[model samples]
Target: MRQGIVRRVAEMALRIEPNRTAVLDWILHTPLPSLGMQTTFELACNGEGERVIALLNDLLLQPGDTVPRLPQSAPPALH
Candidate 1:
């Protein structure tokens, strides 16, 4: 179930970012505005992994633009 969630999020993000590595990086590195500027990792850390999946589902229902992306102001993903 955990892998399923990660894969689902990756697939959804692929629509906006084609590169798998970059998408995963964004997932772990980017802070979502809808979740109080918290990265998905942070959300999971707070024991809200399921909630993040639910939020992603809700966001998926809306237009593509509603989906979150890595902020330009954020530093590049570390090596």
Candidate 2:
């Protein structure tokens, strides 16, 4: 489940950012405004991994929007 979450987040990042290194860096270091300024890496550690995935999915829903939706159910499979 952890790997699935990571892959889903990375896939979403690549769809928008398209740079693997930058996406990884952002995931590990950058605090997300939507996640209440918590970095993605941090959220994942505290049982909030689904929130990160939900944010990515919400981002895809609104290409230019930055507001994050409330976390929902487990994300769909990558394939």
Candidate 3:
């Protein structure tokens, strides 16, 4: 089963890259040097989903990088 964090990372990547197929391909096949040459997909499946998310977040925060603002909404009403 895919983790919520993994899904969230893909959503964020789409906002940044705007190419779903390329982003998915990178997540599944690109070996990240920062991750010991492991693909993000493998990390996500190997119980390192949060790490993959963190790596993506770090990439967005890099100098001159355009990090998309996450959509904000008011908290749901309490019953």
Candidate 4:
């Protein structure tokens, strides 16, 4: 069950580092302070799979201005 959650996290982290070994290593070793200083795998073993997923989802989120922009002042309409 722990491996399952860890693998799921690795799958998500793959977008950051395509290699399975490196990504797996990261998930197994990287300490996430936001997760109470637990590594992804450790947090998963503690039965917090959803939280780990959320962390990865946040990681996968692209940085950008996601807010919809208002249209500029319109030109005069034709008669």
Number of the top lDDT candidate:
2
Each prediction's TM-score versus the true structure: 0.56, 0.69, 0.70, 0.68
Q: Which stretches of candidate 2 lie over 4 Å from their true place?
A: 63-79
Q: Output the TM-score of candidate 2.
A: 0.69
Clashing pairs in 3: none
What lDDT does model 4 reach? 0.67
Backbone Cα, N, C clashes tallied per candidate: 0, 0, 0, 0
Select the stronger candidate by lDDT from 1 and 2.
Answer: 2
Model 4 misplaced regions, further than 4 Å: 1-3, 65-79
- Computed on alpha carbons, the lDDT of every model, listed in order, comes to 0.67, 0.71, 0.70, 0.67
Q: Please list the residue runs of candidate 3 whose C-alpha ends up more than 4 Å from where it truly belongs after superposition.
A: 63-79
Position 44, candidate 4: lDDT = 84
- Screening candidate 4 with a backbone cut-off below 3 angstroms (N, C-alpha, C), the clashing residue pairs are none
**Candidate 1 residues 1-79, lDDT tens each?**
3546666666766765688888778778887766788877677666666766776566557665565543333556899
- Position 41, candidate 4: lDDT: 70
In the range 24-71, model 2's lDDT, one tens digit per residue, is 887787777667878777787776879987777766798555753333
User: Which stretch of 10 consecutive residues in model 2 shows the poorest summed lDDT?
Assistant: 67-76
